[model samples]
Every structure is written in C-alpha cells, then in structure tokens.
Target: MSDRAPQPVERRLPTEESRQLVALVRDIVSKEIAPRAAEEEEAGRFPREVFTLLSESGLLGLPYGSDHGGGDQPYEVYLQVLEELAAARLTVGLGVSVHSLACHALAGYGTDEQRAAHLTEMLSGGLLGAYCLSEPASGSDAASLRTKAVRDGDDWVITGTKAWITHGGIADFCTVLARTGVEGPRGITAFLVPGDAEGLNAALPEKKMGMKGSPTAQLHFDGVRVGDDRRIGEEGQGFAIALSALDSGRLGIAACAIGVAQAALDEAVAYATDRRQFGRPIADFQGLRFMLADMATQIEAGRALYLEAARLRDAGEPFSRQAAMAKLFCTDAAMRVTTDAVQVLGGYGYTQDFPVERLMREAKVLQIVEGTNQIQRMVIARHLAGPETR
Candidate 1:
C-alpha cells in the first residue's frame, strides 16, 4: 500500500435500456470473464462459454432491431457495451465486433426473406461469424480482390481465398466478398457463405503476434455453391456495403483500442503504487507520475473521439471520415499507452508475468486492421477536400 488514493470509478451515463444493459454486462464480465482472460489468452483457448453467456444475455444482438430478436439499441448504447466488454477481456470485445461484421451483410442489404430466415441466428446464436473480404493480394486495396464467383443459373459457384479472417476456423458462417465481373469493385458481389458449405475450408490458424485467443486463418471457397437468394445485395453493391460496414467496424476497433489502453493504464497505476524505489513508492516519482498522467489523458481523448463518431452515426449524419479519424487516433493512442505501461513497470513489463506486454502486442493489430492508419489518413484527407478534387 503506497499512498495513492483508490482510482476513481466513473462510468459514462446511458439511457435506461443502455444503463440496464451495461450493468448486466458489467456483472457478467466481472464475475465470469475477467477471472479467465489471463489463462485463456495465455493458453490460446477460445472462450466458448463466454460467447454462450453473451448470447443468452442478448448482448450479442444489442444493435439490431427487436423484430429480429435483437435489442433495437442505438449505436451509442451498443458501442458502450463493446467498450465495457473490451475492458474486461479484449477477446470477447473483438469477437463481438467480428460477429457484427459478419452480420452486416444481412442487416444492411439482405433480402426480406433472407432476413426472416437468418437474422435471429446471426444475432443471438452461440456460434461466432467471420467477415471474408481480404485476400493475399488485396488488403488495403480490397476492391482489387481476385476471388471469383461464377453464376450458374439458380446458384453461384464461388472460388477464392479470403485472408486474415478473424473467426475463420470457428465461425459458423461467413459474409464473403467475391469478384463476379471483369472490372474492379463493380465486379464484386457479397454473399452469405455457410461455414459448412461443400468445398469450403479454413486453413490452420496463423500464429499471430497477439489476440491469440481469437483465431485467424485463410478461408478457401472452391466451387462452393450458394443460391442466388444468398446474395447479400445487387451485383456491384458489394463495395458500397463493405465500405459501410467498415464505417461501423472502425468504431468497434476504436472502442477496443480504448479498452486496451485503459487496461494498460490500470496496470501501470497499480504497479506504480506497489513497486518500491529509493525508499518510497515508485508512483511518487515525478517521472513515473507524468507517464501515468499522459496515459490517462490519451485514453480520455480517445474515448471522446469515438463517442463523437458513434453519436454522428446515431444521428444519421455523415460519419465515414469521423470513423476513420477515431480508428486512427485511438489505435495509435493504444500503442503508445501499452508501450508506456511496459515502461512504467520497468523490467517486469517486458516479460509475460505482466499483462501489459500482451496488451502492447494486441495494440499493434488495431493499427493494422480495420484499415491501416495510413489508409485512414488517406480517407480523412479525401473527405477534407470537396468531391471534385477528391
């Protein structure tokens, strides 16, 4: 016990439904998820039980409409749940985001009949889902993907490899982007490809630097058959759908970045109080104190940026540029916070004995995924100019 006051516990205010949902999520995370995060993350084990708990609690469907067995919650409320979940366990937070990405095709563009049949399961099922858009050749330039889907009368035969899918091996379904025309994005189409479809397979998991518990792999669709009815939207609308999904998905990544940063800050503050140096707590040192202050400030600013973006979305304002801004800023903040957290702990932070190292590793991916920071800057710059010049 060093003489630092107990860290203040403040939460963002929410609507009545959001308040109830947040409280329930907090309880579940504290009692169930937090205790196991370390073991599962270290062992690279997926928390299937946690996924079941989230579904049963109806958290998985928070952003969808009540008609689809979802909570009909606003983006504002739903993103807060994501922030809270990320605070407890990054894996669960990211899993939710990936699941939402998988469902975007259905929610945004699915036919009424398709929505009637799969929306509920997409939202509340214990099974996870993946978004398949990237390829070996088309990462930042997703529009240039080469995976092909050939229409065969009543069905489409898809043949392509989707790279860097978050829930690749374990997902129950995948929203796939495949090239159907000869040109660029105009040639692409989106489809709901069942995970168990014939000729569909996931490669063995890729060994990643972080987010070990969440699986990543290449999804191979070799002549996988899908009814034309399974097409998510009109041909050539895939690019628009994908971009719109990213507008939301970027916010999710921002929320997770904030959570990772907060975790690192929390660990740093705790360590500073307990660690002794020069006959007093290390926290009392001006050097360590300044670092903590900076970390906290970054986290606060990052939170504000994403919240503003979420508000813009809820208000039906143009938010694509803002979403890009939030994702770029918060993830950069996360990388800094986690790295400084390791510094605050000195030698111990460099080792696996502490969670900060893992958090640091996790932060890197946020910058890479959901559009790289470079791509985000490009998007923001283009938006800053008028359409003619852009």
Candidate 2:
C-alpha cells in the first residue's frame, strides 16, 4: 500500500459547524477508532469505551432534538458523520445507527414526561440502547410477530423472544414491541424496558461472518413487566412506530454501506499504486484502472443517493420511497465494490492482513438488516404502484 495517508473525503456541508463536526469525527476516528478496529474485531471484542467517548463528545444524538440532549443537526449531516465512523470501523458506525433506532420510539412518540424522564440520559449520558422488533419467525413479516404483552392492571407483562438484536446483552434500555391486542400489526405496542428488568434475559451473541465485535443475539422476555407509563404511543401503534423508525434507519445503513465501500476502495487504490506488476505499478494497467474507476463512481453515486434521501427527510417531505431506494442501491453497490476491491488486490485480498475481506463480509449484512433489499424493493413498489393484492 502507498505510504501516504488517504485524503479526507470532500463533503458539502450546509454550515461551518457541520464541516467542523466532520473534522472532529475524523480526528476521533484516527486517534481512537481506526487504529484498534482490526485487532478488536479479530478478538471479537466490542469497544464500549469508544461509544462512551462518542456519547460524551455529543456524537451519539446528532439527529435528535437539542432540548433532549441531542445536537439537532439535520439528517444530512448526521448521516455523513455515520459514513465517517463506518469508514474507520463498521462496528462503531452501525452501533450508533442501532442506538439511534432504539431511541426513536421514545423521542418521537413519548409524552413530555417520558422524554424528560429518559430521553436526555439515553441520548448523551453514555447509556447504550437496543431496538427489539424482530422475532426468529418474524424477521421480514414483522406484523406477524408473536411476542405478547398482557395487561396487569396498571402494568404490562411482556413474554417472548426478540431475535437478531444488536447490542442485545449490553444495552442499557430496549424499545420492545410486543402483541397487546388482536393479531397482526395493529396488535403491537411499544414499550421502553430497562435492559436489566426482571425476566429480561439475553442469549449468547451469534457467531457471524463479519462485525464480530458488535454483538447480535436474542433477548428473551419472560413475563417482563413495565408500567403503562412506559408505553410509547397509543395502544396498538407499535408497528407504525417501528416502520417510521426504519425509514430513517435504512438511510443510516445506506451511509454506513458507502463508508465500508469507500474504505475498501481506498485500500485497493493504495495497494494497486504500490504493488508492482511486471515492470510497473498494477494501478497503471487498463483493466485494473477501469475497475478502480468504477468502484469510485459507485461509491460517489451511493453517497449522493443517500444524501438526497437525507435532504428529503430534513425538509420534512415524504422520503420513505427514496430511503428504500437508497438503502437498496447503496448496499448493493457496497457489496459489488467491496468484492471488486478484493479482485483488485488479487490473492492478497482474501487474507485477513487486509481489511477489504472483512468489509466485504460486513457489506453483506447491510442488504439484510433493517429490511432486506427484497423488502426495500417491495416498499418502493408499494409507494409506486400501491400494495399488491393476493
């Protein structure tokens, strides 16, 4: 690889503050995150301290309200920060995204009392959060989830398991969805449960192909009880809340995918310029040069796509369709670009000595999480042509 440091990405920020925010993120990444990423990831160790630092630095709550201990920045700016963090380490970037997702219900649907009670600590107090919506059987068809929340006077008892939870065992709080009425989506209700609540237990984290540093596990709620005050929105409104959170969460994923892709491209470019083939650098070859060009182009396009969606969100316009499209396109592009980066490195790319292989594995999950690309396409189609009839 080239000895020179990789140049910072050029960004269009609406204000000098946002530009400075990006610079701060980069400084933290260089000093704290990037250096230890490969080692910690290889050891399957999550860097919780880094998250604490991020929280203290006001990086954890950028897209939320300033009154609630958030930065009140636009989604456009928040997502770019995600991209920078992901470039340094996917674990940190995606962990931040999941934390924001976990905070969504309370921020958007909670009463003033609820926000006052918990939002600030959750946002900037170094407390981590997790979102619980998927069950083992209800990954894609979330409306059919079977977790039940039975009424116990002024309290509710939740019973069932949530699958594929990020930060499952470590989160300080979880925004959980459980069935509270009849079957299907309308039956669900959202509740903010303390992670250490009685009867709330986490399984061992899943063994994954990538992002091993970030835990993904199942949480079992065995009659976990919370007061009615913990309920987020109207009774039986959890599904809507979940879907709304996902519209923004998908954009976060899109940004992160581009970050991983960009990192892979940078590695490949550096290696190509430095590795001699025959009598000259491999980067000078026509075929490899074209591949590098395509990788850069795809990364740029994905960045633009996600930024446009973020802008729509910032403007308070309907952005769900664009969000779905961005999620779909950007993740696919990440997979492609990372794979091609591997090719550009020849046999060396397959080894753990380089980061591209890990990036490739991490990119695969982006297409599956939040909602699968298939789900994203269906969402877009529903927006374009309405829901399909059986």
Candidate 3:
C-alpha cells in the first residue's frame, strides 16, 4: 500500500451537465470501485454489482439516444466518464466500453421495430451485453472469421467460436458476427443473440497478465438459433457495422489508456516526493523530475488526442483516421507511462505492495485489444493513402 495519490489531470468538458456526470462518476469510483479494485482483481473476481450500480446511475447508456432508454450524452462526455472509471479500475472501465460496443450494431442499424423491441431491455433493463467478433484465428483480420450463420426459413443457425470475448460467460446478451455468404467482409452479418441460447457455451475465462477481474473467454455457438428479428442491418453489412463500432470503441480504449497512465503518473509523483533519498526527496533530483515531467506530458498529449477524436464523433464527422491515431498514440503512451511509473518506484514498484506493477501489466493489453497498434497504423495509412494496392 504505497500512499501515492492519483495524479490530477484536467479535463475539457463541453457542458456543466457533462462536468456533473464526470463528478458523479469520480465519486462512485473513489467510494465503491477503488477500494476493492486491488483486492478483487487479485482474487480474479468480476465486480458485477458495480455494473448494476452504473446501470442504475444511467452511466451505462451515456452516449446513446434517450429515446431508447439511453442517457443521450455526447461521446465527448461519455469517454471522459470512462477515463474516470478507468483511473480507479481498468476492468470496470473496459467492461463498459465493451458493453457499449455490443449495443452499437442494434442502436445504429436495427430497424425501429427492432429498437423498440430489444433496445430498451438492453439499454435500461439491467442487461449486460458482450460483443462477439473475434474468432480463434481472426484476431487482427476480422473479415477472415469462420463463424457461420445459415438461414433456415424464419430462423438462422449460428455455429462456430468467438475468441477473447469480454463478459463471455456472464453477459445477458451477445451481439454476434457470423459469416452468411461468400468469403471476405461482405459475407458477414450481425445478430443479437441471447446469452443463454441453447448450445451457446463460453469456455473458462483466460488467465492473463493483468486486468484479471475482467472475464475474457472463448464462446462456442453450436447450432444456436436466432430469428430474423434478431438480425441487424442488411446482409453483408456487419463488417461495416463492426468497423463503425470500432471507431468509437478505439476512442474508449484511448481514454482508458490515459486513465491508467494518469494513475501511474500520480503514483510515481507521490512515491518520489514522499520517499527519502540522501536525507531528501528523490523528486528533487533533476533525473527523476525529468522522468515525471515526460510521463505527465505524454499522458496530457494522449488525452488531447482522444478528445479530438471524440469531438469529431459527436459532430457526426468522419473520424476514423483520428480514432486510429488516438488509439495508437494513447495506448503506446500508457505502456510507456506505466513502465516508467514502475521505474520511478524502483524496487517498491516491482512488488505487489504497490499498484504501479499492476498498472504496467494492465497497460499492455490496451495496445492489443480492439485492434493492435500495428493494425491502427494500417488503418491510418489507408485513410492517408486511399487504401493499399492489392
């Protein structure tokens, strides 16, 4: 238990309401989330109740339309809330982002009747949802997915496995992507399948380097059946839908990354100032002071990058390039900041006695999830160079 305070990071919210929302989120994080984060994560316990509290507080649907039981907040606000939550615990913050990703397909593409039927339950009915897209072999190349959804009169039978699913076993619903036509991206279709659908089973959660409290598992869909009403968008529109969702999800990742970096920076500064070296604080040294300064600078730059992307999204402008850029820069920044945080604490940082070690481990995952930083570079290049020659 290092007595390190989380470093302060200023936010540029657009409204008083958004500021209030961030305040509410911070209050909940400090009181309910931060206290149990280290203990529960060490025990590999998912804080399902915390999600219930978030749902009750209307934090779950912050960026969604109010018409369908959502908060109607802009992405700019919702992402900041995510950053505050992540500062306390990455599992909860990332969980909310994944839930929002799961909701995107139906919210953005489902018919009005479909929205009326399922969106309310999903958004406000205290249901937790998982996004199912990655397959065992298709981590970076999503279009190469092997899951199959065959049409059967009024129903579709989905069969195959989804890998690295968040909330895999406990989610109330799963927004699934399965191939229905020819090879490549166009064959994919999206379905909102019930979590407990017969023949749909989740494997045991994966043991990981960090963020152990968040369940990540493989899901097996063995002849799981869904009706036409469950389908989202036209046939072959799923890849596009999934891509659009990732554009937003990447921003969520960027925010979460900065939160981790900020937490690390706070820990390092607190430890350096309090711990004595040569009868004085080590922070007084120019070498350590420079490290702290660089860490703080990187975290601020990452926050600014994500907020720019978020603003573009709120304005309904093309933001995919910016989203990719933010995801790449922020996550890389988190990795650096967290690693530097551990260095700042020296031996104390390496031990479980401090949270910086955990922060470092957790920061590694953000670079890989949603899309690898390499994949982000590819996306940015495509945006800049107008797609690569085949």
TM-score winner: 2
Q: Could you say which candidate leads in lDDT? A: 2
Cα lDDT tens digits, model 1, 111-217, are 88999989888888676789999998999999999999998999999998999999887888899989988678798899998889999999999899888998889
Q: Which regions of candidate 3 are displaced past 4 Å?
A: 1-7
> What's the C-alpha lDDT at position 119 in model 3?
92
| 43-148: candidate 3 lDDT, tens digit per residue | 9999999999999899888899999989999998898898889989999999999999999999999999999999988887889999999999999999999999
Clashes of 2: 0
Superposed Cα deviation of residue 317, candidate 2 (Å): 0.2
* Local error of candidate 1 at residue 390 (angstroms): 11
Q: TM-scores of all models? A: 0.96, 0.99, 0.98
Q: Return the TM-score for candidate 1, rounded to 2 decimals.
A: 0.96
Residue pair clashes in candidate 1: none
Overall lDDT per candidate, in order of appearance: 0.88, 0.96, 0.94
Kindly report which residue stretches of model 1 are placed more than 4 angstroms away from their true locations once superposed. 1-9, 386-390
Q: Between which residue pairs do clashes occur in model 3?
A: 7-266
Q: Is candidate 2 or candidate 3 better by TM-score?
A: 2
Give the true-structure RMSD of model 1.
Answer: 1.8
